[model samples]
Each structure stands twice: as C-alpha cells, then as structure tokens.
Target: MSKNLVIIGSGGDARETLEAVEAANQAGTADYKVLGFIVEARYGTPGALVSGLPILGDFDWFAGRAGEVVAVGAVGSPVLRYRLVERAARYNIEFGNVIHPGAVISSSVRLGWGVIVEAGCVLTSQVRLGDHTHVNLACSISHDTVLDDFATLSPGVHLAGRVRLGEGCFMGIGSVVIEGKQVGKWSVIGAGSVVIRDIPDRVTAVGVPTKIISSQPPANWITQSGEK
Candidate 1:
C-alpha cells in the first residue's frame, strides 16, 4: 500500500521534490502517494494549486492527520528548512525522504530522515546525509562526505572525499570543496567558490580558494519568525 505524503513548502523546491517522488514511484523504488503541500499560513492558501498539487493547508493541517501522512521539508534555505522541520515535529509528524530515480547512490551511504537527493546526484561510498539535508541537481558527493542536519547543496556543487558540512550550512551553486575540508554550521559558500580550507560558523565565504567575506551571529540566520 502507498503511504500518504506531504511536502512542507510550496515553492520551486517543493515542486522539484514532487517530481522526484513521482519519479521514484514510476521506478518502483517508493510507494508514496504525495497528497499535497503544507506551508505556513502566511505562505499558502488552502485549495490553491501548485504544480497540480493542492495547497492542503498550513502546519495545522497535520493536526489530525499525523498518523496517516508523512512530510518532507523542501525549503531551499537551510535555516528555514530547520525551522520548518522543528515546527512540524511539534505535531508528532514523521518525516519522509525523496531520492530521485536519476540519482546514483552507493549502497554504503547512510541517509537520515527528510533528506532529498535530486536528479543526477551521485553519492559515493560511505556518504552520510543528516536529517532534512538537500542535495540539489547534479551535485556530487565523494567518498565519506558528511552533511549534517539541514545542510543545503545547490546545483552542481561538488564535495571531495571526507568533506564535512556542519548543520544548516549552504553551499551555493557550482561550489567545490576539496578533500578533508570542513564547512562549519550555518556557513554560506557563495556560488562558484572553491573551498580549500576549513570555514568557521556563521560566515559567508566566496572566491577560488574561498575567503570569508562576511560573518553574522546565529540569531541573524535563525529568526523567531523563521524569516532569513
């Protein structure tokens, strides 16, 4: 039997997640029947259509349906995604994951709940992806790479062997991290940057052999209203 699933977000990432679910279903790798999207009340209206799926309601939509449905966070921002996951967990919601059929993942890879590995992604042996992590289109994670909770890898990002991304880190599109590097929690690597060394927490780095361009406190990234 197929289980009911909902995506927590109604934006482009959510639609792309829906497509991954559909592809997984078609490939016979998953038996989930995606019901719709559920976002914050401020972001969506009930019955609105998104990529042909209904905007079921807000987080409150899970009030009586937690036992019957699973959810996956699809927000693009790592901090926002973490906030959404924590919010949904209050309803005792069980999180689901999406692995697009086009992704090639090693048998030794370990993935946590709510992780999304999109099309053309290649996760090599011993890779570990923590809860609510998002590996976007065409990203490549080499052997033993680890992505902590709510980490976001933009399209075409590449991580060399043994790299570790701390919680809520965001690697921008086309970014590259060399072997044995560590990106600290909530750090941001700008698009096309090449990280050759370790990055500290709550900083933004860019350039070839990336440089720390800016830094902020945790409160700046995670706000009470969940806005970045």
Candidate 2:
C-alpha cells in the first residue's frame, strides 16, 4: 500500500522533490503517493492546482491530522524548513524522505527523516545527513561527511572527506569544501567559493578562496533547531 504524502512548499525546490518522489514511486523503490502541496496562506490559495497537484491548505491544515499523512519539507530555506518540521511534529505528523532514482548513495550512508537527495547526487560511504537536509542536483558528498539538520547544499557543490557542515548552513552552487573543513551554523558560502578552512557561525563567505565578508546573520535567518 502507498502512503499518502504531502510536500510543504510550492516553489522550485518543492517541485524538484515532487519529481524525485515521483521517480521513486515509478521505480518501485518507495511506496509514496503524492497527494499535493501545503503552500503558505500568503503564497497560494487552497484547492488551487500546482503542477497538477492540489494546494491543500496552509501550515495549520496539518494541526489536527497527525499520522494520517507523511510530509517532506521541500523549501530550501533551512530555517523555514525546520519551522515546518517542528510545527508538524507537535501534531505527531510522520516525516518522509525523497531520493531520486539516479542518485548514487553508499550502503553505509544514514539519512534522517525528510532528507532530499536529488538526481545525480553522489553520497560516498559513511555519509550522515541530518533531518531535512537538502542535497541538490549533482552535489557530491565524500566519505564520512556529516551535514547537520536543515543544511542545504546547492547544485554541483562538492564536499571532501570528513567535512562537517553545521546546522542550517547553506553552500551555494558550485562551491567546494576541502577535506576536514567545518562550516558553522547558519553560515552561507557564496556561489563558486572554495572553503579551505573553518567558518564560524552566522556569517557569509565568498570568493575563490572564501573570505568572511560579513558576520551578520542572513535575512530572516532562524536557527536550524527552530530556536528564535
């Protein structure tokens, strides 16, 4: 029997996750039947269709319907993603994951609930992805890398062996993190940057050899654990 699944968000990331789940369902690797999306009240109208799927309702729609549907957070904003997960958890809603059929994942990899590994992603041995982590298109995560909760890796990002990405960290497109480097909580690595050393919390770094341009928190940033 296929479980009813809902994706929270209606943007590009949400559509990507929907595709991955659709592929998984077609490949018989997963038993999820995607029901639709739950867009925020501000972004969409309930009962409207998006990508052929209905927009069920806003976040509050799940409040009293826990355990009846499995949900996956599809937003790329780490803070917003955690907020949805934590909120849904209060109602005992079960979480689901999405992995594209084309992804290469090692047997030793451990993925937490609601993790999304998109097509062409390569996750090497002993990789640990925390809850709601998003590994975008063609990203490569080498051996023993750990991505804490709500970490978001953009398209074509590469992480060398034993790297640790802190909670809610965002690695932009085409960025590279050398071996054993640690990226701090809520930090943002700009596109095409190369991280050679550790980065501290709540900063934005950029350039070929990444430099911390600002120590300020990202706009609308919240902790990965949903702490204010």
Candidate 3:
C-alpha cells in the first residue's frame, strides 16, 4: 500500500515537491499518495485548493494522523523549517524525502528525512545531506561534501569536492564554493559569491572571492507573519 503524504506548506516550493511526489508515483519507484497540504490557516481556508490539492489544516492537524500520514517541509527558510519540524515532533510526526525525477542522486549518497532535492540537481558520490536540507533547482554538489541539517542551497549553486556546510547555512543563487572550504552554521552567502575560504558562523558574506561584510546575525528566517 502507498504511504499517504502531507506537504507542510502551500507555496511554490510546496507545488514543486508535490510534482516530485507525483513523478515518483508515476515512475513506480516510490509508493506515495499525496493527501494534500498543511498550510498555516492564514494562507487559505481549510479544504481550499492549493496546487490543485486541498489545504487539509495547519501544523497541529497532523496530531491525529500519526503513522497514517507522513510530512515533508516545502518551506525554504531553515529557521522556520526547524520550528515546524520541532512542532511536528511533539505529535510524533514522521518525515519523508521529496526528490525530483529529473535530479540525479548517487546510490552512495546519504540523505536524511524531509530532504528536498529539486529538479536538475546533481549530487555526486559520498554526499551526506542532513535532515530537512533544501537543495533548490539546478545545483551541483560534488563528491564527499557534507551538508548539515537545515542547510539551504539556492538555485544554480556549485560546490566543489570535500566542502563542508554547517547547519542552517544558506548559499544564495549562483554561488560557488571551492574545494575543501567550510561554511559555518547559520551564515548567509549572498548571490553569485564565489567562496574560496572558510566563513565563520552567524554572518553574511558576499563578493567574487567572498568576504565577511558584517558580523551581524542572519536575518530571521521566520518572519513575524510566518512566511519565508
């Protein structure tokens, strides 16, 4: 029997994950039946349509559906994603992976729960992606790289071999990290930056050869309104 899945957002990312699940179902590679979404009630009314699927309820809706329905976060913000996962944990919610059919992932790669590998992504051998990592479209992660939990790789980013990304790091679109460098936890690499050296925690870096512009903490991934 197919496992019922609940996507935990109703935005574009949620739609993309839904498409990946549908593709997996069509390819007969994974047994998943998408039941609908769990949007924060402010987004829409319960039972209303999102990406052609009904909005089932909010974060608390999964409490009664344990074991019968699994969840995967479609939101991009690491902090918010972490918060949602923690909330779900109170009810013993189980999470699943949403890998796009167009993406290429090696058998040797280790993926954690609620991981989302979007379309056109190529993950090479020995890549260890941690729980709730969000890899956006057309990115390339080379061999032996480790991405810790809640890391977000924006579209068209490239990582050379042996790179290590700490927990909750965000690499903006078209960014490139060279071989063997480490990006510390909760750091944000701005768009199109080329990282050639190590970046410390809780700062925003940007430039051709990425430089630490300020020592400020990362912008709140979760806004007051709870949107990414």
- Top-TM-score structure, candidate number: 1
Winner by lDDT: 1
Model 2 alpha-carbon drift over 4 Å, by segment: 218-228
- In model 3, which range of ten residues has the least summed lDDT? 216-225
Off by over 4 Å in 3: 216-228
Report the poorest 10 consecutive residues by lDDT, candidate 2.
219-228
Q: For model 2, state the Cα shift of residue 15 in Å.
A: 0.7
Model 3, 1-228: lDDT tens digits are 889999988888889889888887787767898999987778868999987889998777887878888899888777777777777777888999988888999999999999999889999999999999999999999999999999999999999999999988999999999999999988899999999999998788999999999774445544444434
lDDT of 1 by residue, 66-144 (tens): 7899999999998888888888999999998899999999999999999999999999999999999999999999999
All candidates: TM-score:
0.97, 0.94, 0.93
Residue 200 error for model 3, in Å? 0.5
Q: Model 1 off-target regions past 4 Å?
A: 219-225
TM-score of 2: 0.94
lDDT of 2 by residue, 95-205 (tens): 888999999999999999989999999999999999999999999999999999999999999999999999889999999999999999989999999999999988999
Order candidates by lDDT, high to low.
Answer: 1, 2, 3
RMSD (Cα, Å) of candidate 2?
A: 2.4
